[model samples]
Target chain A: MREPRFHEVEGRSLAYWGLAALLAAIVAAGLTAAYFMEHIGHIITGMTNQIVWGVPHVVAVFLIVSASGVLNVASIASVFGKAPYKLLARLSALLAIALLIGGLSILVLDLGHPDRLIVAMTHYNFTSIFAWNIFLYLGFIAVSAAYLLVMMERRLNSYSRPVGMVAFLWRLVLTTGTGSIFGFLVSREAYDEAILAPLFVAMSFSFGLAIFIIVLMAAYRWTQRPLGGAILERLRNLLGVFAAGVLYFLLVYHVTKLYEAKHRGFEYFILGTGGIYTLLFWIGAIFLGGMVPIFLFYLARYRHSRAAIGAGALAIILGGLALIYDTIIGAQAYPLTIFPGMQVSSSFYDGVVNAYTPSLPECALGLGGVALTLLIVVSAVRLFRILPENLADIAFDLDPHEIGATPNRGALWAPADGR
Target chain B: MTRRKAKRELDAGRRRFLGMAAIASFALAPGVRLIGSAQSSSPASARANSKVRWGLLIDTNKCSETCQACVSACASYNGWKNEGRPTDPQWIRKVAIRDSETGLARTLPVLCQHCAEPACVEVCPTGASFRRADGIVLVDRHICIGCRYCMMACPFKARSFVHQNLTDQRPQAPRGIGTVEGCTMCVPRIDAGKVPACVEACAREGRGAMTFGDLNDRNSAIRRNIAAYSTTRFRADLDLDPSVQYQGL
Candidate 1:
């Protein structure tokens, strides 16, 4: 690849300018809202005593799930020794780190005592799922960053491969832990399904692969880089398989809930009055997130087209968001029946029937999280030149007798010292 | 015959004198050292043996939703601000419950059940929440770290977090922002040998909706009521063995 060199570029691109403006507006609105919340308490938001956690929580979960998804590219390429995926591995790592920070930001804003968040780490509640999630998320972020650093430093390419694997495994466990936060609440009854954890795992992979393909296409378009056709095709096929798996799991999860009949009220809400959530799950998540992506990848021409890849990526992201929204909202839609044979009339104002709409401030904060993620990713990309601009010309084979041998092995691996 | 009558009268007089002397000694026992010692020891022993187990029995069927007397009494006694945004200082609240099958509803007053085996007590890392020997559960807000795990662990949703900054909080209750709180069964009242605010309020209304007494006392009205009428505990399957029992509804 002619020994990658750095050169100062001219004025910022139009895309960067647009992103900056959007970010500024979002941050300003979020700050104003946060100030109001701090001064007046959570009453400024739609969240009431019954609905303690509202839209910010949903948005936070969505970002976290997507972040976990972003980890799959590195897991597939570096840890699993998938050669075709290696070209996009660095970009995926950056996205994973970025999205996690975004998720964390949204979560902090949602807390009643944002200042007391450190208590989550300081005060350990072994039995509380929320406490466990706090630790798991922190661990995931740490391991992911370490692995990314190892990759960036071009250090211990061999030993760090296992480190990447460890990171990947940890993130999968973390994602499952997040899912179990809702799933393990047996008292809630609405979220007692055992399949939610595995379902989240499937989502992580599907969303991760979808994001990888889209980023790869964008990187190629912007930098005039050309990733190998063989690699792209392999990724598209894997994504199709993952999308199918996610769809299957989602279907089984719902069917099992219906069959149990105990949580029928929750099922009714998801399949009935939870119209928007139901549509998002069925149409956005299943068809757009799963079927459409799979179909696009199946067609030879569509798989290679930038537009098709972009559309598939957009669908997967939106679908992932919808799934998270469904999990959180669906769990709370039904009231906890303390008395058997007692029916409570659902009201729009209080208790189980409490409705929530994200205020402008909450939406702005969510947008700010997205902006922050992009800012981080773009800065990292600018500083380190993480993404390989010429994937085909970069020699993967290192041995003298190999057809694509390169003499750069010492340069890449020397700094690691096998530590 | 005259001699026999005189002898009988003499015997009766001697018996009456001995009985009067015994009565005088008993009345002056506190002044006599030996008798005083005996009386003091006996009363002290009785005091040492006595223990009070405070509890409440609520008749949900007879409870009137219209009467806020209990809430008012509790607030006034505890010096809780009853106006504005109802704060977490509410020790007792009337929760309106609806029938899941019939959609028929009734207002039921819910307070801390004061479970014998409280999950909140078990989960408090700082030991801020504990069940007393008298069977009342209380949160020592002074040491509370404001962790909401107790809230989640509680089956009855009995705990509430204080959310606003505070000044001049009542010394007896002493609640502040960032502390979990629940009904105390009016521990202050119990110590004074008076009925809890809710029980007194219910009694005053002549509905007999709430009865408070020493659960350990078999003769207590609460104990008799619970035995006479069928009662239910919220989420009894959890096996918390709650101290509070509800009747009729």
Candidate 2:
């Protein structure tokens, strides 16, 4: 068995500069949009009293959830001791950190008084889950950074497993905290379910791995690095499993709500006649995000096809967004049941479906967050020895037992399982 | 003779000590009052007492669906109006409700419940949404980051976020863009030793459907009415202990 050599990306190419510049421009545009929304007020955006959180939040929440999930790749390598996954560990940590920063940027910038962020930082509201999540998100970034250091530095190599274990537990709690943002709300019927926490965890795994596959494939192909089919197959299969887990949770969530008389209206709104919400749930979340990816991964003929694998991963990402959109906005659109047996109407838009259309600036801001994530990842790979020099099957064809002892500070790496 | 003399001396010292303590209390009274007044303030009403729970009772039976006097009064006093948009802040609104089963209809004014335990107060990431000692829920404009979690958490749809900047905001009511605002229960008027604008207007119209009083005071008009009538709190199933109660709904 030989140790895999790691090196920094040569980012001097024209295409590299072009991509970075494009991302930078989008980030700038997003900042500009935020400035107008802040000083000019939220009226400039599509956000109103009814739909307070719009496209920016949908994008932000998606990134934050996926950020926690992206670290699973490193957790698999270091905590579970999966040798094949080890090659992707550094990039995983980098991507996780990048994605979180991107998501957090959107959330902060979208605030009504983004300037008063200092107040949020200083104030202590221990009871609020949103307050707790501030620390959780920050702690994850800190922990993932430490995990990356332990894996990269031979001087701290032995601590990787312990740190990885901490990160793994932290991410699970982080996702739970994220889900509880909605789950804890007694007012909204769509969010009050206990299953939302685990559902988010499942979603993270699927969404996280889907993006990882896309990034890994793109980075390897572009860098002229050999990403082995063996690892790809393993990751794709895992994605299928995670997607199925999400599906199972969704089913339980709906069935349990259906059993309760109080939740029947919400369930019907999302599943039956709730227009876009129902379409997103069925076609976007269930069919595209769930069934399509799962089927693509499991089918015998498409098993080895790179195009199928990539498409399946892309489908999962798109579907994950749709699911999140359905979860966040769809629930909000359903009018709140203020009166149990009464049909209420008021000047306040009460007892009626709230209308929301995403403004362009909001769309730009949302896209900016995604671009920022890619920009950070793109920039980091060039600056640090985050990517392995090779991931060919021949390089990783080693015994599982020999993999954990991987080489020193930015020097040695290995793929553990070939048996 | 010696034991009796010692007991007399101790009693004399105890009397002297009590006199000094009383003098110290008198000296510290002004200082204590200054500190108390500096810590918090009531803009609309005189000092809110912990013993007082300002509440409202609305008799839906007497409320006319055609008359929006209370809503108009609230809007005028709070410096908020329809502005021809759904996004406009409604400090108070008239909701027309119809029973789906019985085909019975009722109209009532809906505003911040000023709940004893408010969902908005519980979920505000910053302690911006708060309940005062007198059970009046208020939003601190400086602390509210406009996350709108309070709006989402509020079961009554009581709170509203300011969608746009305003040039002519009332000097009295708290105002900020990217911040949440709701019914302050006319704290300024209460401070001025007056009823809320809506209550005053309702009374002026001779409808007298709305009553604002201290629910804690057993002898108060609101408490006496509650004692005599069958009343309902909106979404009582959640057990929020709302200060506002409706009769004959």
Candidate 3:
């Protein structure tokens, strides 16, 4: 394809400002919630000594993991030399940066002392996995930014392949580090599995692309740029494969845990006896997040339905959040085995499931991170020539549905008027 | 007196066995004397090197579930209160453990293990969680960012995050908002030539079930007791080499 043209969206419309204003309000509320946490303390939240890391952690991990995974499109284009993904590369790199910033913001703000961020930067605990993550996250952001620059600077275009290769390798390590954050925890039953590293990589692929498709379609539709059905089809198919990868990893992880005599109680607690956790694992992560999305992506009945595809992406995000919560909080709820082959009871809530009802401030703080991510993405796309001018030529030629169809012109994300 | 009761009688006065000269040469050199002098005189006092490794031995047979003097003593000494809520900080707490199959139950007071190779110290993003030369795991509040990753790493569930702002912190245990705090093994008291508050309470008011001494000194009361009896560390399979060992499971 002759060098495709790109341009900034005309963002002065009421829809654009209204959306920005709404997100800004949410961000403000989230900040207020963070202030309450820092000002008052984590006591206001549902987290306790038992369930130490709470809902905010779930959101932050989701965004951070997805940020690393979102680079796949750019990697496919530059690293793997795929022409179709090349057109989407710029947006992919931009989204990765925005998502990372958003995730990192929540992580820092929710700290016991967000003020001591400088200390985290200055002090180096070489042995700590968490400390290693600080470097990994910063490196991923820096490398991805340079990759974007190489792709944008026509003179530096040749460097995109090498830079993209570095980014791809860095992303793998970044996701592994993220997974190992939980995996290295020898204490907890649910988080100790070595498979969590690859599981998170698969999760990142599914969650990142799901969010990418939603954002891509929204940006194109709102700007009245024709998004070809071909790209969406390819994305949905890839999303299916990625989702299956996550499911496969999870199955292997669960089966192996079940095989262990020591881990049986924890497995049963999550799969059966644990109330909210069990519900989240079965209904949210397994059915909606894992199964429904896969079916929506592949089934012929919903194949051409843009709304179905959008819903599939949304489900993956929600389900991924559920999985994060179940894995983190659920394992914590089960008491640590202080004595082997013994049941322990304590005022510290031992041998019994710890209850956690996430408070408003924790939810608000988490939501603020989401708003911040969207706001960053929207503002960046508006300020820069990230989106292609039109995918009409590519779509009209390859996508049978887009060949003769007339869209309603004012629709958001799809031709959903009568669908 | 019964052998167990006779041991209880010796528990309180065992520190006096080390001749003052021996005490001055051994205990005071690496621990109490230098740490005490550091607090009273200047910050430049000699560092407590690895010559000493403080440890505790608790006899579960004497630690009754109904008595919470050790817990109360720790709270009173540290100026923290257990509000009975899940979020409350329990520097040291009582646990009632029973065998799953045999249904044989026992009571024990669980606190910081002060592991020789602490998981908390290993995972802290900042080097806030640290082990002193004398084998005490501590959180340096000034450096702790409160990520609580250490809590996740600790096998014993021995650490607690200060969930709320505090207005009632004692000088000996200076805690504040947002930092992770746990049983310090009464570092201040240890430096001042005193046994930990919990151990003292267990000796004075309760069952005299606890013994504190330098583990490196084979002649020390704790090491002698462990050598004479079958004692085990919690989660010994992980091989963390916790300073705290227990007897009579």
Which one wins on DockQ?
3
| DockQ each | 0.09, 0.56, 0.60
Error of 3 at A381 (Å): 1.0
lDDT (10s digit) by residue, model 1, range A231-299: 555566677788888889988987887887666766787777776767877787777888788777677
Which parts of model 3 are misplaced by more than 4 Å? A393-419, B1-47
List runs of model 1 lying over 4 Å from the truth: A1-14, A17-21, A228-230, A299-301, A345-352, A392-419, B1-56, B71-106, B111-196, B212-229, B237-243
Model 2, A143-257: lDDT tens digits are: 9999999989989989999999999999999999999999988888888777899999999998999999999988877776666666777788899999999899999999999
TM-score of each: 0.76, 0.90, 0.91
lDDT of each: 0.68, 0.87, 0.87
Q: Order of candidates by TM-score, top first? A: 3, 2, 1
Worst 10 residues of 2 chain A by lDDT: A405-414
Q: Give the TM-score of candidate 3.
A: 0.91
Q: DockQ order of candidates, best first?
A: 3, 2, 1
Best by TM-score: 3
True contacts kept of 1: 0.12
